[model samples]
Target: MAFSATARDSAVAEMNITPLVDVMLVLLVIFMVSAPLLTKTVDAALPQIVPPSLDTIKPLQMQLDVGDDGSYRLDGRLLTQSEVGERLAEAAISDPRAVLRVHASSGADYQQVVTALAEARNRGIANLSVQH
Candidate 1:
């Protein structure tokens, strides 16, 4: 271009907004096409939490230990089978809902442990369990 002095002055005074309008329209079309794609959602299965029930809550339990010498101990106190039965009966009488959790030593007699459990049951203990 060969522009006269008057034409140059006129062009300088008028703003050429074609590029601006074209850029704005291109941006609008790009956003219009990408808007829905960006708004797309994925389906997910979320885990739900459940409140604990009475059954789920562990009961208050007492420990019964069987020593290597076939001796019985309730709460670290040594006792004979009859004493164990007496203690268990007392505990059962105190709290019928409580559990008697028995733990036998690795070298303990299994039959004696079973006998202790039977004693607890004989004393009207309904909640008898063994611990690992």
Candidate 2:
């Protein structure tokens, strides 16, 4: 007895994933080849500096305290906002590169400290520091 070929089996119902894997690998290779070109380039030139002499005297410090009652003090002496510049000028004459340290009480207004700093700047005080 001989067996006969017959179309009695069902057709394939699931997709073959080999082609999908091939496409994904191709895309990966393309991206790998182009990745370096996508990077951004930056051009910059920095200046060189010569060190200064170390024998320079330290900057003189002037303290400005702002009290809770909106009062201002210059080195423990009470003064108004307008007086801060005048006093700073006098201090700077002794030491041109003087630092102004401004201290404000916890309850003091922020604007009071700002005004004091402005006045010090106007007086050509090069160094300024704020103390908590």
Candidate 3:
């Protein structure tokens, strides 16, 4: 039925925030110590070149088609895989900058297309492109 004001006033009045501040300072020191260790450096050398003349001759286009049956064609004319390499080599010999375009049927074997590309590379054909 009664309350004591003097008894309440005797209790602790200051908040204990020292532990929180200590933890924050420890975390800050740990970050500062490990910051340089977390950083990384990388170096790279890029290429430099002179632009080609605008009046250079345009390269001729050679089209290679691979059918679903694994058959090959050069410019719509059916040919064997060996014949394809021979034809590409012949074209390259005439014009070093000849361009090759490859087209493969949806059902065609992926290895066939790769083989065609490899053959062209072996024959020094650099300007190669593929058509879906």
For residue 6, model 2's alpha carbon misses the true position, in angstroms, by 93
lDDT of 3 by residue, 66-125 (tens): 999999999999999888989989998998999999999999999999999999999989
The count of backbone overlaps in candidate 1 is 0
Cα-lDDT of candidate 2: 0.83
- lDDT tens per residue, model 2, 17-112: 999999999999999999987896777898867557644557787788999999998889998877777888888788888888899999999988
The lowest-lDDT stretch of 10 consecutive residues in candidate 2 is: 3-12
Better of 1 and 2 by TM-score: 2
All candidates: TM-score: 0.54, 0.56, 0.58
List where candidate 3 sits over 4 angstroms from the true fold: 1-56
Best by TM-score: 3
Taken over the whole model, the C-alpha lDDT of each candidate is 0.87, 0.83, 0.90
Model 2 — TM-score against the truth?
0.56
Candidate 1 residue spans exceeding 4 A from truth = 1-60
